[model samples]
Target: MLWPTNYTKLASATMFTLFFAGATFAPKRMVNGENIQHFLQRHYCNAYKYLASRLRHLDAVIGFEVMNEPHNGFIGLKDLKAYHPTETLGPR
Candidate 1:
């Protein structure tokens, strides 16, 4: 996939990248006294809770899963500002 043109536009740009940056990219600390990963997780939990509260009474709605296909966004990279991956492959 083509890399995004703007890397720092986290809120409205690529969501998967944002998920990685917010959820799992480490050196886990606080920005302005807020742990962003936990903040993101709390939002997910709250959404699930809201859905469960509304749907638990129904017989067919049997389950819920959060963080579907969670990705390690930029977790192991040695450099943050440079595009490192040199290749991409399509269906063979």
Candidate 2:
């Protein structure tokens, strides 16, 4: 019977390199704040509208994520107004 010798060493080395690299270079964490959801929603909506207009085929893309962390507590009509008194809260 014939056996391949290089495969095991190659796999082991690749795995070790990836593990160490990930440990050494972790991704930056995001900070959460009360008005962060509203801020993100406002900016993303503008961007999405622009993109949809330019790429007419994507007009159906009407939804967006507020943030990776959903601020359910900060996502109410009164809370939104309190955060940005100048801005009016639209339909929920």
Candidate 3:
């Protein structure tokens, strides 16, 4: 009694879809836009600082350029203030 590969894949997909159905219909609030922005900023800042501190004098490691790349998920939560977090609506 072994399931086919496609069957397993479909089953997994269906299960996840079901689990995330609420998110599809409404905001999940899994991530906050401002929090995520700050989190990424802190992440890169710390990494660069740590490396720069250790290897500042090294010629190859003259400078570390930190990129501030942020992503807004499906709900488009970049600016949630106007829409605001509530029982129904979320930032878009």
Candidate 4:
């Protein structure tokens, strides 16, 4: 899973595109080889627990946002059983 020091040298110089080639070092726990649904569900559950426990005392606090400006992470047609690329990082 070790990449060359100069990963940018392989693709069009944009390392972001190259990251889709593998799932070795994922960002924000989002990788190519892992299960996208499980990863996002874990994040959501943890966030909900934290908010429900910590903010329960505050009456004004109804809910909390899981993430702000979240990225799509590493997803593609392989992760989802679809004819097109519909494995987006949302309620798909």
By descending lDDT, how would the candidates be arranged?
A: 1, 4, 3, 2
Candidate 3 residue lDDT tens string, 1-92:
23322222333433323333424533333335433334444565788788888897788766655532221222333444543222222112
Over 1-92, each residue of candidate 4 has an lDDT whose tens digit, in order, gives: 23322322223222333233323433335445554445545566887897699879998987777554333333333443342222222321
Give lDDT: candidate 4, residue 59: 83
The deviation in Å at residue 85 for candidate 1 is 6.7
The segments of candidate 1 whose C-alpha lies over 4 angstroms from its true place after superposition are 1-33, 81-92
lDDT of candidate 4 at residue 85, scale 0 to 100: 24
Kindly report the root-mean-square deviation of model 3 from the true structure over all alpha carbons.
Answer: 13.8
Q: If both were scored by lDDT, which would come out higher, candidate 2 or candidate 3?
A: 3
* Candidate with the larger TM-score of 1 and 2: 1
Residue range 1-92, candidate 1, lDDT tens digits: 34442332333223444444654543365556666666656677899999899998899887977654343445454665653332311111
Candidate 2: where is the Cα deviation over 4 Å?
A: 1-34, 57-92
Candidate 3, position 65, lDDT: 54
lDDT of 3 at 29: 31
RMSD to the hidden true structure, all candidates: 5.8, 21.1, 13.8, 12.0
| Candidates sorted on TM-score, descending | 1, 4, 3, 2
In candidate 4, residue 81 scores what lDDT? 31
Q: Provide the global lDDT of candidate 1 against the true structure.
A: 0.51
